[model samples]
Target: MRLSRYFLPVTKETPADAQIVSHKLMLRAGLVRQTAAGIYAWLPLGLRVLKKIEQIVREEQDKAGAVELLMPTIQSADLWRQSGRYDAYGPEMLRLVDRHEREMLYGPTNEEMITTIFRDATKSYRDLPRTLYHIQWKFRDEVRPRFGVMRGREFLMKDAYSFDLDEEGLKQSYEAMFVAYLRTFARLGLQAVPVRAPTGPIGGDLSHEFHILAETGESQLFYDAAIDDVTREELLAADASTIARLTRLYAMEAEEHEKVAECPVPAERLRSRRGIEVGHIFAFGTKYSASMGFSIQTADGGQVHPQMGSYGIGVSRLMGAIIEASHDDNGIVWPDSVAPFQVGLINMRADDAACSAAADNIYKQLETAGVETLYDDRDERGGAKFATMDVIGLPWQLVIGPKGLEKGVVELKRRASGEREELSLETALARLTAR
Candidate 1:
């Protein structure tokens, strides 16, 4: 992608209404634009990052034996009514009347709808343990939707629902998703701690919320410091015992953490930090199935409500969460795994013919080598080009300047670290491609 042909509308001045670093930088970096209060139109760059996060979530879900299927944004209000939550869910539910005067809503969650689907499809225990998920947009009608995408009223989400015939099957299914969430966040360059949390409207006795630590986060969390040492591979291969070991450690949100006297961990082992809730898992046994009359036949030919669990990850909110956890003074320092583009190819001397030619050739080489490169071929000053690249925060910046090109070298810089090295074009291409 060439910057001259791109639609990035970066700004020098930050929006006055923007409160947090992620909100301010997202505006300044031209990632998204506010179309309404608590709603946004994801610009090209922002959409790329959102899609990358979505794909990662999908891959992890697949690994955990969950099948993918999309559900509609709009759901029948009757679904909620059948589940006995039509009146219970408050103003956050975006309820509306359709053309026929039928009550409908933009779904805030899909527990009822998924339960209905499972009931209609499966009649016996043979179809017992099935996990289905979808990545889709949801509307909550937040009274005060601020902090950019972090608390947006309209946002993307990955919601998975698991159906099992028995408690043991439900436990196993929940553990799979629990481990998958750990791996998902780790791959996205986040250190998320799973803390015991309230189920709220989801109505589960067992629940955990995965929070990513950040200084500007909304939730105050208390957790054991040992959570920081867990690895992705270890979590992915974890069993019931492994999960129990981690869950036994002290971890809770501020509201629950306030009862410090009840906490098991000593003062030294307990760590407090502000964190953003990126993922949540619930093992709500028969909450929706029983309410919605979703029952399967047991081996003894008796009807039994299928146990269920729901797992959710805020797909769009993750962009803001990542920025909150990863950005520096300059701009977002995107991790390579989720960066919009792996390399930013800047023609520092865009007006110089030699520099332009070299940059063009290098860009082609990078593309041919399957590296996602953004070529800054705009007729702009070197400083401006560098600043723009930094603001976007690709993993690497390949600068082709007149002086460097004349010396048979190009400057390669790591965005995370302000480290630079002058190397031959061949060498630069090799390193970037290898990454």
Candidate 2:
């Protein structure tokens, strides 16, 4: 993508309403714009990042043996009513009435709808174990939606529903998703700690919330320091035993930690920090199926309610959570895996014929090599171009200038660390395009 043609509206001044680091940085970086109090329109740069995150979530879900299918944003109110949650769900539920005098709603979650679909489609015990997932927009009427996408009323979510014949099957599906969440966060360059959490409105007996540590986080957490020692490789290689081991580690939110009279970890081993929740999984046996009278035939030919579990990863909120955990004073320090563009190719002297030719040649080489590069061909000052590159936070910046070209070398700088190296144009291209 060329910056000259891109619709990036980056600003130097931070919005006064943005209280958190992610919200402020997101605005300043021109990733998103607020259309309403709790709704945001994702700009071009922001949409790229959002889609990248969504794809990662989708890939991880697929690895967990979940099949993908899309669900509608709007759902029939009769679904929630059958689940007995329409009245009890409170103001967050965006209730609506259609012209035909029928009730409807923008679904906050798809437990009721998914249950109906799965129940009507499967009748025999052969379809006992199935996990279906969807990446879609969800809406909830938050009373005070703030902190940008972190607590937005309208957001993208990756929700997976697992249907099993019994409690044991549900546990297996839940563990699979738990491990999937760990791997997903690790790939996204986040250290997510899974802590036992209350089911709340989901009404599950077993639940876990995955949180990323950040000072600006809303939830206070007490966890074993050993949790931090686990590497991304270890998480990616995780299995049922690894999942079992991780769950045994001490990790809980403030509310849950306060309920315990005896703290398990030694004072030195126990660490306290603030956290932003990015994912949640619930093993709610027969909650939706029983409530909605959804039943299937068992092996013994008896009617039985299928056990269900729901897993959710906040696809949109992750951008804010990642920024909160990764940004520095300069701007966002995007993880290479989730970065919109792998390299920011800067024509430092766009007005100079030599610099423009060199930068343009390198950009063409990068494109041919299948690199996602954002070439800054704008007729702007070198300082402004550099600043834009830093704020957007691509993993690398390749600067082309007349002086460097005259010396037969170009500058390659890593965004995370302010480290730069001057190498021959051929060498720099080789380094970037190397697999």
Task: Give all candidate RMSDs, comma-separated.
Answer: 1.1, 1.0
Question: How much is 408 displaced in model 2, in angstroms?
Answer: 0.6
Model 2: CA > 4 A from native: 259-261
Please, what is the TM-score per model? 0.98, 0.99
**Model 1 over residues 97-212: C-alpha lDDT tens digits?**
99999999999999998888878999998887999999999999999999999999999999999999899999999999998888888789888888899999899899999999
Which numbered prediction scores highest in TM-score against the true structure? 2
Clashing pairs for predicted structure model 1, backbone only = none
**Worst window of 10 by summed lDDT in candidate 1:** 233-242
| Clash tally for model 2 | 0
**lDDT per residue as tens, model 2, 157-207:** 999999998889999999899889988999999989998999998998999
Clashing pairs in 2: none
